[model samples]
Target: MHPSTLLQLALMGLFVASIPLTMVWLSADANKYRKLVWVMAFLTFDLIVFGGFTRLTDSGLGCPDWPGCYGAANPFIAHEQIAAAEALMPTGPVTKVKAWIEMIHRYLAMGIGVLIMALMFQSVRQWRKTHQQAFAPALPVALFLFVCVQGAFGAWTVTLKLQPVIVTIHLLLGMGLLAMLVWLGGREDYLLHPPAPSRDLAGLRALRTLALLAAIVVVLQIALGGWVSTNYATLACDEFPLCDGKFIPEMDFEHGFTLWRELGKTAAGHYLQFSALVAIHWVHRNFAMIVALVLGLAAWRAARQPALRKTAKLIAAVLLAQLFTGIATVFFDFPLAIAVLHNAGAALLVLLVTMLNYKVKHLLDVSQRTPANADLPANSYR
Candidate 1:
């Protein structure tokens, strides 16, 4: 948090951000804004995945400080402090490797922040030139603000000692950033190739609603998963189809669902009950059924529409992979690799569902705009 450390962090962010900025500048694509949007989207996705890796490794508090490592810019400078922490507790959170992992995650996040700032600037400049909706600066500006808030939560994750709610919200906000970026990219893609008039206006309208519902369900499932992870309840049950040898599995939802308590503690400052952990794991496990059903239905409906077949396939594939990873983590005792994949799968689902939503809305719009569709009945497309 010192001035020198702040300067070093700023330079690091700029250096990391310059890679994509340079790529966008030199690309053959005429719409550099779209290119930049997508590059940030990809980087944001990486950030989310790396974040999961950091958490899975119990490295969230590696640096034990925000924006820097032990008041230094990098782990090397803070080696003495980290070493002391590790020396005090050999297997604790502040080991040298963990400090590196946590700092790298922070560096990537800062780099993404710089890219979002660039996006907002580019959007404003482009809007001044063309005044097109695609280049509107509002969402970019909002992204800028949102990332700042997310960064705050990142700091709180460490300073508050990884309070479950704070960490969970931080993960959710990262996913929200990905959702916004994907939607923005989709907007640019739509502008580049507008949709053709749909032959089934009413069908698309219904599918749009379903896609939206799927997204909501996925988000909820993610929230539950985050709760389970942050609370270290992933192994509470240790069995798939049955939780602790019973479908119901004794659970304490009252303490488990308490929103604002510290990690592993009840609101009354008592240690959380084992049943509470069971409740956390149980709900996430069962709710996945709803997620599969809703996403499967959306994918099925979208697959029937030629324009959406590819995206539908991706949704279905990722869904299966996600479910498999989730179950594997249980059967395999939550290996780090599979656990990280489970998180990545969730992010991919968010991206795919957002894409589905965008395409359906576009198709519905195209159908409504056709002159021949004016006299069509409620269920008619032709």
Candidate 2:
């Protein structure tokens, strides 16, 4: 929290971000802008996965501070404080290992923030030089602002003692950042390789609707999944197909759905009951079925379109993987690796859905233009 500590953290973040920026500069690819966007997207995805790892390992409070470990820039410098905390509670959240995990997650997040800043800087410079709308600075600016907000939530996740709502929103914001980057990258790709004009307006409209619906379903499922994780409800049911070995198990939905409560407590500050945990897990479990059915239908419909077949395949594959990991978490009592992969799978699904949406929107844009340019050849739009 000190000024010097903040400066040190910022420098560390810049140093980590420089590695990828250096790679982007050295690459032979002509479209460095697109490459940088994609690289950021890739790193953002990794950050989300590492974040899951951090949460699953119970390292969120490893430092008991934000943006630094125990008011120190690095865990090494904060060793005395961390050791004292561990001495007080050896098996608690402030162990040396957990501090390192928490710091690493923060470092990655800061690195991403640096990259986004660089992106905004580059976008502005390019737009000024070229005066081209294609080189617009809007998205990079928006991303910079969004990452700032995400960073705030990240701090709150630690400072608020892992309040379920704050933590869930943190997770959702991270995925939302990834989704935005993927859309930006997809937009760059479309600019580089415009698709041929399409006459299938009706088909495009249908796929667009399905893709949008699928994206909505995925976001809701992710929110539910986040709630489950934040509330530590993964092992509440401890069985498959039926919760507590019954079709209608007793649950406390009123307490379970209390959005603003602290972790492990009801709205009225009472210790959360097992029934509430069961309710959280049960809703997430049942919703998975609905998400699967809806996304499966969307993927099938998408696969029927020749242009979107590959994206559709990816959606199907990720959906199946998600289902496996979801069930495996229950069957295996929520192993760390499997649980993290479940989070990664959710991020992947968001990426795929965003891609599908972009592709369908691209097609729809072409379709709308096709009628006006009907005198030209189909390939002329490209």
Candidate 3:
């Protein structure tokens, strides 16, 4: 929290971000902005997955501080404090490894912030130079703002002692940021390779609606899953197909769904019951079926379309992998590797669904254009 510590953190972020910024500068891609967006999207995906690893490993409070480890720039500098904490409670949260894990996640997040700043700067500059709608700073600026909000949540996650609601919201915001980036990247993709006109207007409209709906469903399911994870309810049911060998076990929905409370505590500050954890886990487990159905239907519909066949195949593949990992995580007692992949699968689903939505929208736009407006530049529609 000291000024020097803050400066050191900032410098570290710049150092980490420079690698990707240099890649974008040196690349011969005709559109560096597009390349940067794609790269940013990729890193954001990694951050979200690593975030899951952090949470899963109980490393969220490893540092037990914000933006720095033990009020220092890195774990090395805070070694003494971390060691003392670990010695005091060997199996507790502030071990040296957890501190490193937490700091690494923070560093990666800070690096991402630097990249967004660069993106926003370039976007604003390009918009001023060309006055093109594609270069409009709105989305990039919004991304910048969203990342800021996400960072605030990150801070709260630690300072608030990993409150269930705060932690769950943190996870949701990270996913939301990835979705936004994917949508932005999809827009760039269309500009890079404009889709051809589609004769099937009704079909395109239906697919677009389905894709949008699928995205909404995925987001909600992710919220449920986040709640399950944050509440440490992954093993509450401990079995697949049926939870604890019952179709509907006893549950405490009122405490389980309470919005504002400390970790493992209900609104009344009493210890959360096992029934509440079962309720949280049970809801997420069952809701996976709904997510699978909707996304599967969307993928099925898209697979039949020549234009969306590739994206559709991706959605199907990731959806299957997501289901496998979700089940495997439970059957295998939430193995770290499988669990992280499950989280990664969710982020990938978001990316693919957003891409499908954009593709369908592009085709619909092409189909809707008439002779009078068909001549307008594609950027105009954007």
Model number with the top lDDT? 1
CA deviation > 4 Å runs, candidate 3: 372-382
Off by over 4 Å in 1: 374-382
Report the C-alpha lDDT of model 3 over 242-324, residue by residue, as the tens digit. 88789999999999999899898989999999999999999998999999999999999888777788999999999999999
**Candidate 1 local lDDT, 104-206, one digit each (tens):** 9999999999999999998999899999999999999999999999999999999999999999999999999999999999999988988666667767888
Candidate 1 has its poorest 10 consecutive residues by lDDT at 373-382
- Please give the clash total of every predicted structure, in order: 0, 0, 0
Q: TM-scores for all candidates?
A: 0.97, 0.97, 0.96
lDDT of 1: 0.93
Q: List the global CA lDDT of all models.
A: 0.93, 0.91, 0.91
**lDDT of model 1 at position 304:** 80
Identify the runs in model 2 with alpha carbons over 4 angstroms from their true place.
Answer: 372-382
Superposed Cα deviation of residue 14, candidate 3 (Å): 0.5
